[model samples]
Each structure stands twice: as structure tokens, then as C-alpha cells.
Target: MQPTKRFDAIIVGARCAGAAAAMLMARQGMRVLALERGAYGSDTLSTHALMRGAVLLLARWGVLQRLVEAGTPAIRRVTFHYGAEAIPVDLSPGDGVDALYAPRRALLDSALVDAAWEAGAEIRHHHTVTALRHDQTGRVAGVVALDEAGREHAIAADLVVGADGAGSAVARLAGANVQEEAGHAATCLFGYFRGLPDTGTHWHYAPGAGAGRIPTNAGRHVVFVSVPQARFKAELRGDRLAALRRMLREDFPDLAETLGDARPDGELLAFAGRKGFLRQAAGPGWALIGDAGYFKDPITAHGITDALRDAALLADVATEGTPAAFVRFATRRDDLSLPLFRVTDEIAGYAWTLEEAKALHLKLNGAMKREFAALTAEVVS
Candidate 1:
């Protein structure tokens, strides 16, 4: 087929990773196009916590400042409770910078898309990629997409980035074997709370197998409970929200009580996926970023941070004379993601234990506080 069209890059999925990647490349003078199935300013049931490291990356992108001005605030400390014992980690205010800042996902993602658009990357919203086209040599040369009106169209590019998130079609198209780890059927229930008990926007890690609350801006908080598939079924039986709400009251009363007063400000969210990965993050002319590559349990609240990191590294590596930029991007991702894998693995193991839970909770609480402080200061989450 003739070259459909050409540009420096065509980005699929305009969330944080895609938008940031598009922005970075565009700022460097490349013509970039970003396609997002989701609307620019819509809300999502996302666990929008950014670790300190991810927080720092956002600052460099210029959107961080906008978020702050929009009333997004820093979250300094994380507290843990196990067996009536409380472990509070000091997330002191910015000694000049706070390590972590919390914002709603709608606001966060919208800001990112706006930044990409402002940087000169054209965005096609409500467009869904239907298929990917590979050249005879097997490089991803273009994508076949359906716009909001369902018209099929082809767009070619030097590179096609798949930031389409967990259920990424690009990863599959690139021959990356996506697999869910065995025995990893962890079901999650989460949502934002508007009115909570006088809880100081501090993340709360409760006693039990696993229960927690992450605070965010504008009186928004994310509360969730992770349970085995069997337990999840047993608890929900159908009324998942009721089961989840009951879980909070009984197993994590402190958080439950706070949320009990909380009005559901957004959709109640559910996450049912293995802490999974794509065996290969790229091939030929294509690459995967963010949740499209490595996605772990929300237990560590690493989603946003990981997305920012993925975007930053992609900017430097996915550039000129690099046929292997995609591979390099994947490699850099592996290097960064491996540690996170280990950390999440440990957290998962510890979360399943009732006896060792307290010690592990305290240890993690301390780490989160420090990390959170560092995040607000634009250090790293």
C-alpha cells in the first residue's frame, strides 16, 4: 500500500503516557498526532495517586504547576493501623518541596491532554484504533482507526505508540505476549469520597488482609480493598458495593467510618486484573507505555507515577536515527519496572499475611510518607 500519511509519530491513547510522549516529541519539533478514545476532560474511576518519582516528572512537563494552581495539594504523610496499633509516617510539608501531590484523575489526565495539544500535537478524540498495519518487513507503519462517527481511516507515521492502557490492542498487534500471572485474580473496589470524617487527608492503611485509603485534592479520597477472587465473590455475591462498604466498616473501621460520611463523588470503580505484563513492550515501529506495558496492583498506588516515568524515558529514547528506539524504550522500562515489580510482589505477599501484616505495614507506611513528601517537592514519588 502507498504511504497513507507521514509524521514523526502517531500516538494511540491520549492519557498521561501518550500525551506526555506526544508533548515531549512535539516540543522537540516533531509533528505528532495523538488519538484518545476517551474525552479530554472526562472523569475516570482511577486510583490517581502519583508516587514521588512520578510527581517530579510531571513538574518538568509544565502541567504540574497548572495542577497546583487548580487546587491540587500535596499529601505528606501515610498512616497505618494494625491490631489497634497506629503507625504514622511523617510526611512533613515541603521544606521547599513536597514529594507527592494528589489530584483527581479527570483533572490530571485532562491537563496532560491539554498540554499535548498545546505543544502542537493534534489530538483526535473519540477515535478508536481498530487495527494496526505492518509493512512487509514487519514494522508498524500505520494504524487503521475508526473515528467517533465510525468512519475507517488510515494514518501512517514513523512510529506508532500504543498507550492504550491495560487492554492494549497495540501490544497484541506487536506480538507481545500479554499474560496474567497465575493465582493473581485480585478483585478491587474503589471510589472517591467527598465528605469524610476529620481525617487529615492522610493515606490510611488498615488492619486485615488488605484495606486502605489514599487521600487526594478537593476533599477527594480513594478507598479500596483487595481480596482474593474467592473472597471477593463471597463478599459481593452480586452487590459488590455493599460488600465493599461492609468490608470497610468491619475490617477497616477507621477508613470505613470516614468513608461512611463520604458522599460518592464519582463512579464506584472496580479493577479485576492480574499484576500483569507484556512479554515484549515493542516491535518494529511500535511501542507500549504505561499500563499498556506493565500494570501492577493498585496496592502500591503506582499507576500515575509509572505513567510519568514511562513518558519521560520515552522522550529521550524514542528519537532520531533509532530504529531500535522502541526496543530501547522497552529496555529502559524493564530496568525501571523490575524494581517496582519486586516492591509490588513483596507488598502482595505481605498483604496476604495477617500475622506479618503489622510489621510490614509500619515499614511501608514510613516509606510512603517519605516518598509522599518527596513527591510534593517535585523530588520523586
Candidate 2:
């Protein structure tokens, strides 16, 4: 059967990775198709903070200005609280980068999609990828997607990318192998609040739990709590809001005090810990990026950064469009991701005692320092 429509690439998931990939490839004069199951600009559960690496990529793609113009606040410092002590660290990503930014998912995802559209990529929201389509040679040829009208559509392409997320449909259909995995450690709960006060990005850690607060656009504060899943269940007895409030007051007293008259603006959302893993990112005509290929705990708030990095890296290979390009993309993705994954796993384990937590925190900071120094050396050389 001959397909009616064809593209250079078909990307499932139109959030950060897919949209960015489409934008980059389209800018390079490739015919790209991006599909998203959800409506455009919809919000999802995410840390929302963009690390230095992600910010740099956004700047390169010309989307950072759009985010800032939309009112995302700049986070210039980070304060870590371990028990009764507080340590403030300045966040400078070198090469004159002075601050980090956390924008609401709605704003950020839309910007990426807009960039892709402006670059001449075809985008279809409310389109779900039903399965991967393959040729007789066993290489992927395209995808089976269901459109908004509940009708099935066959879209052919030279390459198919699963930027769909941790539970990626394309990865599953392609049977991508998991090469490395870290076990689940904690449960995460978060909500947005109005009238809350913040001093940059703040983190608090105790024996069995950790919490953080950051200001986003519209002067809203995003607060989160991560605790051992078993302990969280036992303490809450299924009352999530009560458990969240108690976790704040008991484990993060200072952060709780700042709540004052702050009222929650949305329903409290909770997610159980899932092990993070690195999947075989590419095979034949298919490749994966974002949470689809590698996922780490949100404790480090590095998901968006990792996603943007891979999107850019994969886009480069896609531009080359060579037979071995996908394999090279997989190797490069692992080289950059494995170290941060291990570090984040250590921090996400909520079973650590106060002393162990402090030691681990120091180690994490040391790792970041070394990374920054290496970046500086590279730039200088």
C-alpha cells in the first residue's frame, strides 16, 4: 500500500522534545510532522524548572525570549536547607549566563510548538499514535495515528521519533530495550499557590522527606514535597492534602511558616515514584528522546534540561540523515545522561538519614562544580 502523505520525519509527542526536534529539522529544510495526543498548550505535571543547559538550548532556538516576555521569573540563587542549617549558592552557568528560569508548562510547551510551526513543520494536536508502521525490510516506515475525528490515519516518513515521554508508545511498539534502570525511591506531591513568598529557589531536607519552593510566572509559587512512598502512605492514610500540609509543617517548618495566608490555586497532584531508566534510544529508522529514552528523578529538576539537550543532539543527527546516525545519537545521549542520572538517584532516595543527606548533598554540589569547571575549560580552550 502506498501512503498518500510523506515527511522526512514523524515525531510523536509535541511538547519539549518533539516540538524542538521539528523546529530544528524544519529550519534545516526537512519535511517534518509533529503529533500530540493532547490539545496544544495544555498543562501537565512537571518540575517546570529549566536548568542551565536547557536555557542555553532555548536561547539557541530563539524561544527563551518568548518565555521571558511571557513573564517567567529568573531564579538567580538556590538555598539548600539541611536540618537547621541553610546554604546559599549562586547560580551562574558561565559564558555570561547569570540565572535560571522556571516557566509554567503551558507557556513553555506552547513556545516550542509555535517555534516549530513558524519553521514550517506540520503540527496536529489531538492526534494519538496508535502503533509503529514498518516495511517488509523490518525498518520503521511511519506511524498509525488516530485523529481527533476518531479516524485512523497512516502517515509515512523516513524516520520516526518517540519524544512521547517515559511510557512512550513508539518505544513500546519498537520494543526498545532498557539498558540501565534505577529503582523507585519516593512519592512526589506538588501544587501551585497564590500569595506565597519565595527567595529564589529554596530546598529543605530532613530525615525521611525533602521539599522545594520556586516562583513561576504570574507571581505564583510552586511547592513540592518528596518522601519515601511507603512512609507517605502510612502517614497519610489516603488523605493527601493533610499529609502534604503535615509534611510541610513537620519537615519544613520554615517553608511552612512562609505560607501564611497563601492559598492553593489548584488541586494537589501526586505521583508515585517510578524507576528511571535509559532505553536503547535508536534502532533502524526509529529514535527516542526526552523521557522516552532517558528519565531521572525530579529531585534534581533536570528533566527539561535533559530533554532539550537530547532534542538538539538528535536534531543534528537527523539533519545528517546517515545510516549510522541514530546509533551515534544513542551513544552521545548516554555519555551526557548517565552521570546526572546516578547523582539524581542518590538524592531521590528518601531513606537517607540527616547526616547521609548532608554528605550526599555535598557530593552532588562537588559533581556540579566539576562539570562547570570542565565546561569553562572547554570554552577557554
Candidate 3:
């Protein structure tokens, strides 16, 4: 069936990466369509932490102030606890970014979708892409999606971008193979609590276990604990809240004390983790971004940041509208992502000692620094 309408690009997910890509591409005068399988402004499971690179990109795109106005707390310092020792790092202001934020996914994703809409990208929420449409040359040219009413629509575009996340239908249909996969994964359980004292961001680490507290919207702090996936399946069954409490009390007693009488505001959430992967980033006429293309363990809390960064990178090259440009986009993304990926995989293993974890964090920090530098250069040039 022939498409009734055509666009320069059709983005499969309109959350972070897809909306940002649509906004940037629309800003460059391309006709863009962004489709979301979920309702607009809906929330997803997330750590809700944004690193400096993400903050910088949001600022550059003129959306950071919206988050600030919406009451997301500014994170200026982060305390890393290795066993009994605590190391505090003050985020230095530079390149027009003073602080980072941890906005709820509902807010952040909505903000980006709003930005895309304002930039003239057509956003269709509640639309699920069912398959890719290829031209006579056998290159992807559009998508067949089902609307909320279960009506099917065929929409054509010059490019189809899969921002649909880890289990991306676009990746599957396009046969975007996994180029690399991590051997380790970690399971996490988290909940939000009100009345927890504001503590910028706190990361607690003990042998084979980790926990953290991040202040977010509505006077709430998201507190979480992570353990090896094997341990989570084998030992942390039955009462999940009890298991979380036990993990926090044993590995992060101070955070447990900080919780005090402040009970969780919502049901506890769990991420039954999967091994991270680097998928084939771009194909003939389809490209992948965000967790659709590259995913690392959430233990590092950098997924949102990586998504925003790649959105900018892909948008920059996508204007060229050539397969080779997409290749370059993939290459540049891998250059900045591989180190962080390796370090995050190791940390997710939960096989490191206190000293070893600290060293791994240092390596992670160095990789983040390089990513920041690359983004800075992109902004400059």
C-alpha cells in the first residue's frame, strides 16, 4: 500500500532520543514525524539522573530552564561511598552548565516532545510501529504502525530511526545485528520516598552491592539498591521490599537511617537487568539511537545522557542524508561510547573489591570526561 503522506524522517519513539532527534532535524528544516507507543507525558522506569553532558545539551537546546522551573533539583555535588570512606566531588561550572538535574521521565520526555512539537515536528503519540516498509531496492523507506484505535497506517519517510529502546522493533525488522554484548548484568530495585533530606546525590558501594539516593521532583528522593543478577534471582526472592531493606541496611546503613520513618511514596520498582549490547547502529535506510542502538547497565546512571548526546550527533549528520553520513555517526558514537561501555560492564559484574571498584569508577570518570570533551567540541564546531 502507498503512503498517504511522506516525511524526511520518521522517528519510532518520541521520548528522549526520538523527540530530541525530531526537534533537531525539524530545526534544520526537515519534515520530521515522531511516533510514540505510549501516551504523551507518561513515565518510565529510570534512575532519573542526568549527567553534565545531558544537562549541557538540554541547555544548548533551550529546554533545561523548563526542568528547573518544574522543580527538578539541581545536583551540584556527588558523594561516592566506598565502604567506610566517602569521596565528595563538586561539579565545576563550565561551558554554560552550572549544575545537573534529575527530572522525572514524565517531565523530561514531555519536555522533549514539547520541544519537538514546537519545532514543527509532527508528533503522534499512541502509535506503535508494526513493521518497516522497504522500497524496490530493499532499503527501508517508512513504517506501518497501529494507532490507539488499532487502525493501521502506512507512513513513508526518507529515513526511519529506531529510538524505540532496547527491544526495538525497527532493529529487529531491519536486522540490525548486535556488534558487541556484555557478559555481566545487574538487577536493581528502587522506590521513591518523601521527606528524605536533600543530599545532592549519594552513591554507596560495598562488596557486590550498591545503593544510591537522588533528589527529584515533588520533594522526593529515589533510593535504590542493586545486586548481581544471579544473586537477585537466587537469594533476593519472596518479600522484595524486605530484600531491599535488608540490602540497604546491610550495605548502606546510613541511607537506611536517612530513610528513617519516611516510607516509600509508591510501589517498589525492579529492573530485571539484561546484558548490555552495542547493536549495528545504522543500516541502508534505517538508523538506531538511544538504548535501541547502544545500552549499558543503569548502574552508571548515564543512559539519558548518552541518549541526548547521540540525538545531537545523529541529527548533525542526518542532515547530510546519506548512508555514509550515518556510518560516520555510528563511528563517532562508538568512539565515545566503547570505553564507558566496558567500564560499566565491569562495574555491573559486581565482582570487584572495594579498591577495585574505586579504580573502576576512576576509569568510568575518565570515559565520561572524554564524552564531555567530545560534546563540547561538537558545540564549538
Q: Point to the candidate with the largest lDDT.
A: 3
TM-score, structure 2 vs. true: 0.94
- How much RMSD separates candidate 2 from the native structure? 2.4
Worst 10 residues of 2 by lDDT: 372-381
lDDT of 2: 0.84
Candidate of highest TM-score: 3
Q: 1-381, model 1: which lDDT tens digit per residue? A: 344557778889888788888888888788899989988787765667776666667776678898888887666666666645676666554433465676887788889888888889899899999888777887888898888998888888878888888888787777777533422445678776766542434444443346777667776667778765666667765655677788877777766766664556655677664655535666778777888877876666777777777776677666652857656667766765655555555666434454466555456556545544433443221
Which tens-of-lDDT digit does each residue in 98-215 have in candidate 3? 9888999999999999999999999999999999999999999999999999999999999999999999999999999999999998999998889988869999999999899999
The regions of model 3 sitting more than 4 angstroms off are 379-381
lDDT, candidate 2, residue 209? 85
Error of 1 at 326 (Å): 3.8
Better of 1 and 3 by lDDT: 3
Greater-TM-score candidate between 1 and 2: 2
Greater lDDT among 1 and 2 belongs to 2
Alpha carbon lDDT at 151, candidate 2: 86
Candidate 2 Cα misplacement greater than 4 A, ranges? 237-239, 365-381
Clashing pairs in 2: none
The lDDT per prediction is 0.70, 0.84, 0.92
